[model samples]
Target: MNYETFENRVLPVKNKLFRFAFRLLGSSEEAKDVVQEVMIKVWNGREQMATIENMEAWCMRITKNLSLDRLRSNQRRATDSLTEGFEIRQETLTPHERTEIHENMQRVNEMIAALPEKQRQVIHLRDVEGYSYNEICEILELDMNQVKVNLFRARTTVREKLVKINAYGL
Candidate 1:
């Protein structure tokens, strides 16, 4: 793609790209690096994008691959900061309410983080990023049936954990 075309087509999807990267890496800094690497790779390979039907999905796949590569090379999963999360959330509620909400949010986050890698990725792409099943399948390079199954299991797992936490305070 030319400069103008790239600006229009690729640059606009940076937020989606960044969010997907952040979800995968769990660190904003690492996600930013991944997005930059994805952009560079896409730019360099612009010539090969001629027949691609979905550019966003293509870029997402690149982001997923690069993020996974980084994770593998480092031998660690990315971590989100609970304090940082609490700081950025809305403060409209009373202190007590806010604390409760924050605590619950942290619990949910922990539960999601504890999921297996594939389930985690599929859930993030589907729920957090709001992508359709087909898009998720494309981005994660999974078949449609696998994507649906993983997402179903991930949501079910999270729901079960949340119920347990609320019911018994475990």
Candidate 2:
């Protein structure tokens, strides 16, 4: 791709890339670095880009791999804080409602964080990023059945935990 085409197509996905990196690495600074690396890598490999379709998915795959590499090297678990990307409209809700929403979101985030790595990744790419199943499969390098199964298990686990919490007022 030419510079102009790269700027138009690749630059726009930086936020998505950063978000995915953050989801995996659980650190904003590290996520930014990973995104920068991805940009540089993509630019350097521009010749190979012509043959590939779905630039965004390809970028996400790179982000995932780099983030996983960092994680493996660091030997630390991801402490994903979903509120970083989540926004609650302050103007519409009272302070109490806002607090309640924040707490609920935090609870859900904890539930998601407790999931297995693959399940967490599948859930984030599919539900949070709104990627289609095929795109998620491409980004995650999983088959359609594996992606569907992981998503189903993640959602079901979260739902059951929420139900239990509600029923028990826990």
In the range 33-142, model 2's lDDT, one tens digit per residue, is: 99999999999999999889999999999999999999999998887576765688677898899889999889887888888899999999988899999999999999
The top-ranked prediction according to lDDT is 2
Please provide, for model 1 over 90-112, each residue's C-alpha lDDT reduced to its tens digit, 9 standing for 90 to 100: 65778898778777778888888
Off by over 4 Å in 2: 80-86
Once fitted onto the true fold, the runs of candidate 1 whose alpha carbons sit more than 4 angstroms away are 82-91
TM-score to true structure, per model: 0.90, 0.93
Tell me which residue pairs clash in candidate 1.
none
RMSD of each: 1.9, 1.5
The local lDDT score (0 to 100) that residue 41 gets in candidate 1 is 91
